[model samples]
Target: MTAEIRLFPCLTDNFGYLIHDPATKATASIDAPEAGPIIQALEREGWTLTDILITHHHGDHVGGVAELKQKYKCRVVAPHDKAAKIANVDLRAAQGDVIKVGGLLARVLETPGHTLDHVSYVFDSEKALFAADTLFSIGCGRVFEGTYPMMWDSLLKLRVLPDDFKLYCGHEYTASNIKFALTVEPDNAALKARAEEVTRLRSENKPTIPTLLGDEKKANVFLRADEPSVAASVRMKGQSAADVFGELRERKNKS
Candidate 1:
């Protein structure tokens, strides 16, 4: 059976997701940005929270974990790094670890760049990727704890996923991300089209989560660092893809 998913707003710009396994009636929250919205979403969906999958140690990402765990007694799966200090973790997962929410299985991918403890969850069978904070629709997370090269390597890991996988990132940064992306790839037709789409979506107050990986690969310049065109846009032509990626990130940081 296919899993049921819900997307709702959390905090100012963060998103909260609930993935439900219909066969087993197990529901896992991708992250607990806030308890109120998650609880409200669960109540509306009529699904009990069975698991909480944390992607990183950022306060906005984990602020409600403790409350949700205490209320539902749900299992919390977080990154294995002890330095993160997230509370109420039942399992600490690293890369290659497979976590099961009833019949649905998710493979853990260590994608540290924004923070050293960051990770992403990929449900291969369902073609769903929960890449909180690591990747956005048209951009990537800022490298906070890890080096630029490390961040680029982590992005490459996610770039290899099948194009059909649906990416559910952590924020509603698509509009701004697109603006910054256009500066780097001004002549990119795919990006221009995506920018218009994003503009329309935001104008109507619609969420742009769950973008297909294929579409992102076409428009997201962060994922196109290796392309000769992208390299030339920043006057880094013939340089390594990693270096081009770093330049793009630096430009975004300042944008």
Candidate 2:
């Protein structure tokens, strides 16, 4: 049987996802930053929560875990490294570990950057990536706990996935991110088009989740690692790849 995914936006921009397997009628929540929203959404969808796939121990990512666990009696699958902080860890898994929710299987990806203990949950059957803070819609996560290279490598790993893969990032920063991209490379046609489109989408009070990897590659300045324009912009500062990437990221932060 096929699986269905539902997106629940919560707390300004954070997104909590529900992956439901029709085969077994099981549902898993991808990072429960808040219980109220998750609980409400699950109730609306007529789904029962069976598990919580924690990406990291960030408060915004795990704040509602205790309440949700108590309410749903759901299994908490946290990364092996963040077990101590994730709260009520039912299963501790490493990178490449496979976890199940009914007929749906999620492959763990060690994507440390936003946090030292961050991980991503990938469902191969659906080509869906719950990248958390590792990779955003039109931007990458800031380097908080990891260095440029570590984040870069993590992003590269994500970049290799299928072009049509659905990227369910942790936040909705696309509008601001696209604004920053324009400041970085004003001449990028794709970036210009995407920014206009994002403006329209935001105006309609719609969600801009699940951005395709190909669109990010073409429009996202952070993902255009090998483009001549980005390289030239980076080289103008007489810096290394890491330095340039870091600078661009810093610029985005300030923008």
Candidate 3:
């Protein structure tokens, strides 16, 4: 059977996920911002925290790591390159590493863009991605530490996944992002439709994560590196795909 996944939103827009396997009584937390909400969700669901998976080292992402670790004594997993950034790490690996949560397994993806230590956890078995901040609902994370090319390459790795894969990202920034998407892809019927949907979501105060990858490919302006419209929008005086991606990212940052 598939794992039971519960999302508990913490901080302003950050999400902490609980992946539970009823058979083995194993549970894993994708990220921890503050321990209180995580503990609350676990208690509400009657699940023990068996492991903690860290996606990055940003304070908003890892603020409660020490407290959670102390409380659950859970095994902590993180990217090998982020050792200097993350506080504690019981296990570490580069991209393409797998960490099993009972019957389910999550593949490690080194998605450095939001931060040099950033990563996104992929579970092809279940078609879910704990895309910390690199990939959001309609928007992507701001470039904090990694180069634009590095971030674009990281997102490209994820773009090839199955179209229907459930994209569970870290924040809820769909409405505004899609609105900005239209500014760049004005003639795109799919993008306009998505913008309307996202606007409705925000108006209703609804959740906007776990968005579809196929949909992102159609609506996410950043992922459309080859699209003439996006390419034109990204074109500086004159540049390449990497430069275009960076330009698009900067435009999104202001939007």
Candidate 4:
């Protein structure tokens, strides 16, 4: 059976995701921004939390881990390479590790741009990725701990996934990301179309996540850094794709 996903708002712009495998009856929470909403969501679904998957050590991502663990006794799975920095970790996972949530399996992909130890979980059976902050609808996370090359290399990992994969990122930053992406690729019709859609979604107080990576490939500037058009738009023409990616990230940082 395919996993059932529930997306809910948490801690202002941050988001919380719960994935439940019906066959196994195992439920996992991807990054807990706060305990109240996660607990409430679990109660609402009548599902018990079996696992808490963490992407990084950021407070907003893990602030509720302690509380949730205290209440549910759930196992906390975090990045093995950076486990020392994160507290209350029960399992340390890295790239190539496969974690089973009941009958569903998630393959961990180390995506260290937002943070050196950030990891994204991909469930091939569900064609879903809990990307946390590494990737977003129209942009990516800031390069806080990893270098531009590292971030670019990490993003390349997602290229192997099918285009139909749905990306579930950490925040509700699509509207703002679209504004910055427009500055990078103003002439991109797909980006323009996506921006209009995002604007309408925000106008209606709706979530704009769960976007297909195929659409992101066509519209997200960060994902298209290898394109000559994107490189020229950032004045990094004739440069390596990594360099273009760095320049685009710098522009977003300044934006």
Model 1 clash pairs are: none
- Please give the distance, in angstroms, between residue 29's alpha carbon in candidate 1 and its true position after superposition: 0.4
1-255, model 1: which lDDT tens digit per residue?
A: 799989999999999999999999999999899999999999998999999999999999999999999999999999999998899999999999999999999999999889999999999999999999999999899999998888899889999999999999999999999999988888889899989888888999999888999999999999999999999889998999989999999999999
Model 3 lDDT per residue over 1-255, tens place: 778889878999888888988889989999888899999999999999988888988887888889989999988887787445787689886788889877778899889988887878888878898888999866788998889999899889889899999898887778778777778878888788877777776788777777899999888878887566678765553466778888888888787
Off by over 4 Å in 4: none
Give the candidate number with the greatest TM-score.
1
Off by over 4 Å in 2: 236-240
* lDDT scores in order: 0.94, 0.85, 0.83, 0.91
Clashes of 4: 0
| Leading candidate by lDDT | 1
Q: Comparing candidate 2 with candidate 3, which one achieves the higher TM-score?
A: 2
lDDT of 4 by residue, 57-135 (tens): 9999999999999998999999987643788899999999999888889999999978988999999989999999999
Name the regions of candidate 1 deviating beyond 4 angstroms. none
RMSD of 1: 0.7
